[model samples]
Target: MTANREIDSILQRAADGGRITPEEALLLYTEAPFHALGEAADTVRRRRHPDGIVTYLIDRNINYTNVCVTACKFCAFFRAPKHKEGWSHPMEEILNRCGEAVDLGATQVMLQGGHHPDYGVEYYENLFSSVKQAYPQLAIHSIGPSEILHMAKVSGVSIEDAVLRIKAAGLDSIAGAGAEMLPDRPRKAIAPLKESGARWLEVMAVAHRNGLSSTATMMMGTGETHEERIEHIRMIRDVQDLAVERGYRDDAVETGQEIGGFRAFIPWTYQPENNHLKGRTQATTMEYLRFLAMSRLFFDNVSHLQASWLTTGKDVGQLSLHLGVDDLGSIMLEENVISSAGARHRSNLHELIWMIRTADRIPAQRDTLYKHLAVHYTPEDDPTDERVVSHFSSIAMPGGGAGRKQLPVVGVS
Candidate 1:
């Protein structure tokens, strides 16, 4: 009864918009009933959004190059710099992909890639400049702190200079990739060569200070502890608090213009298929849902929380709406990194709308900045565009044909 009372008090405080400590969050995450936790999280979600709308984005993950120097063990996408299969997409190919995305009503393109040794700040400047010059409509939400650190070192420039040059060269925003686990233990175990978690936050702090807004992400199920999970949230919350304290909130009260800060938090599970870190423990569906609820309840300052349907499958994605997920990540036209790691879940715009509606919420299409572009209230108002389908890539199967398929076991060479 005493434990129950503690849990109830924590739930009440969280649902009422009061802040809960990391210890309270862990208790709710580990001890509270699943339905109760989800209910509290849903209440918090409704309070934050207030409009019964679940949002999604229309975007494509365009990996520029596969050649990488820091080959993390949890990755199945990167190839060594000297590998024969290591190839960088040419400028024309990238532009063609952008054209395809634009034609399909996509307003954002995630230009992620490996950290090539020779690619310096100038390479990214030219790439961003050319992309913006060709398609000014497409938002280049690309790169992460890891890439920035590497590029700065390679180009012999400071981190601030690297961020400023990229932003000036039309790099609209940064993607919070490479933040697998913020804690040092698990992070080093999986990605020893990557920048430390504190360093990652430092880089993001610099970006936020320089007017570059970005999303924050956490890669779970990578052999991390419950305490570590809570610590991750704590770290993010502290940084977010700092961002606000430094006058980097979503809106400038004086000018009414947007400023730099984290716009959303996305938590995805680690895929353990063809990577070097295979045969490790993974997060179950229930654990994922629990974390989802806890994140919603804990991240009071963060505005949006996205559901990773790409990693956790479609059913859980739908259920996440009830567990405090306001956004169902994206209708990814192409995703190679997660797919290469055995994530086979895919969805089209139509299916996503149906999923959201089935969850008893309105469906809305949002842009990179979480601005709604279109809202579907009823079936009569549903979009009729058939081209918005998940068609480009599929999980690697034994035979041919790339239909809606499951992941097949491919041996790591």
Candidate 2:
């Protein structure tokens, strides 16, 4: 059979709700017609979600610490211990941030931070417990694999034990961070002291087995080849398969299904700003959208595909909703990690609803776990009632204060 015919057959099978092999996925990634692949993926997305109603989660990212040990080359946000600028937010301050998020209608708070030398399982337990105790309504969905590995060493606890303790402390779910590139060659080159690709998957598997569902992510366009990009997806797929297998064996959920597993797959491009890999090529908007669509097509087991509007701008993010992405990530009231890494794009709830409606998708406010809270068919349908008025202020950062203005809303051109 011709290569094109084989690719078509694979696409057909995937459309029919069947999983495609890695070889087939590679073909689609490499040779499948761009528009054809997009259309095929869109078909699958529409079938699963007939409304094409793209949604954005209501949450905020709170980077609790910038002091880090494993200084990955691609990171522009982390500061070494010796660096005077490196700092960690105290628990009170962190809780204050959570209170602010809750006030702004953020139901989930992403507690991201660098691997501080002194922080360990006890520190996280106290922090998570404190957050849960204060804001019982807010879900604590935070931490990446790198932090988990570092904390296990610092606390002198086994990986399984650390994860179990954290789960017990009220970690709602895990975020797939530090997955710069799943291929070992690039991963080792960037983050030498960090955990191996397999080890990262192992940490996540333990979390899944312990009844914690998390999202998977990939950081692309960071000097890795296109083939390596496909390999990243393949790696996540393999990890997800193993996670499901373990979850089923352990009966991680009461229903005995693959619950407490990977809930969504999110792929975003690398940001090169003040990092070591300066002057590196960044992922273009089209490349990002194409990859977003391919991700929806590739990760058959994953249900929700989230577009990183925080990394890519809102327009492409809006366009991505039609290209098979169902989630627009979070409406981050304040995000330092990515924004510090040169992601200048910003959005608020008003602008968020405008973007969603402009794309012809109903805007629904959702919680951390993707549970629907409210829907807005139009601005009139919005229930916020109290509009968040924009004002001028200055944000104090490690460098200096950058004045804030009203969030921009560029009309459709």
Candidate 3:
């Protein structure tokens, strides 16, 4: 069949509650009309989130260490093991950041960092225990499959054991980082030292089997083809389906819906600044919208589709709401890793309210667990007296202000 015919059929299947094969998905991604694609995806979004209101989370990302062993070429943040400026966040510093997040009304803290050589599961256990002890209200969402692989190897433990130990110490969920690319070719090109695609899925599968459902993410526009993009979605959907099947088998009394599955799927464009893939143009707004809409259509079982304003900018992020995204990721009281990679868009609480209202949707502040805390409708501008916060470099604190910023607290872009 022609690409157009294939896409139309696939879209019809999705609209009619039937699943499309991976090849059909690929064709739809390549040839589906933009308006039709958006409508189809929006239908799915409406089904999942019947309410017209979309949601965002109040959270912060705290990078625990910059010293990395798996130095990917696409990364601009990781420091070599022997680099003079290499460092890790001290326990006190981590605890302080969590406190700051809690003070700002953030209930989630993502403790992402490089794969440090010396750290073990014990390190995470102690850090998680301390964070939980300090702020029991905060959900400790940290680490990805890649970091898990490194930790498992370094600590001489199975992924299952590592997850159980971390959970015991209060790690709530995995962050799904290190997913630069899903296919082996692109994965090898960017982060060869990281675990293979299968291995990454294996670890996440273990986590899901152990009753911890986590979000999945895709990093796109890194010299991959449209077909490859569909494959990435297919891979995640396959895993999600497997997770559902596994859950049913694990418990005799528990129904599939009672067990944890893939909670959300987020796709963000690649940041092509100050990295080995320099000079390569990042994905365009149209491309991002296309991918976002396509992901919503293809991954029908995934609960939420997140718009990545942090990487795509405010206008594109807002536009994404119409293109079938049901959530705008987080407020991120603190976000450095992506900012360092050239995401210049900024937002405060006032701006976030204005954006959401202007788009004809209700803005809600939520916790990491998707529990709604507040629905914001006020359209007031930020107070002029609000102090400006620095962005790591200008932060003046203990440890001589190294890599600390003093940026203003704000909502997500």
Summarize candidate 1's per-residue lDDT along 211-310 as a digit string, tens digits. 8888899999989999998898788888888888887885442345556788888999989999998948788889999999999999988888998988
Error of 2 at 278 (Å): 0.2
User: In candidate 2, which residue ranges exceed 4 Å CA deviation?
Assistant: 1-3, 246-258, 385-413
Candidate 1: residue 160 lDDT (0-100): 99
Least well predicted 10-residue stretch by lDDT in candidate 2: 387-396
lDDT per prediction? 0.86, 0.76, 0.75
Candidate 2 local lDDT, 208-289, one digit each (tens): 8877888888888777777788888888888778776665322233344644667788888787887888846777777777
TM-score of each: 0.94, 0.91, 0.89
Best by lDDT: 1
Sort by lDDT, best first: what order?
A: 1, 2, 3
Q: Local error of candidate 2 at 13, Å?
A: 1.9
Tens digits of per-residue lDDT, candidate 3, 1-413, equal: 23477577778778655777777766666678888888888878777677766787767788888899988888878889989978887899888877766766677989988989988888888989999999999988788888877888889998899988998899887877877678899888888888888888888888887767778898887888777777777888888889867652212212344435567888988887767888385677888898888788777677678998878887888888887787888766666776666666666555665677788887777666565677765544222323213233212122213334344444544
What stretches of model 3 exceed 4 Å from their correct place? 1-6, 248-259, 377-413
- What TM-score should be assigned to candidate 1? 0.94
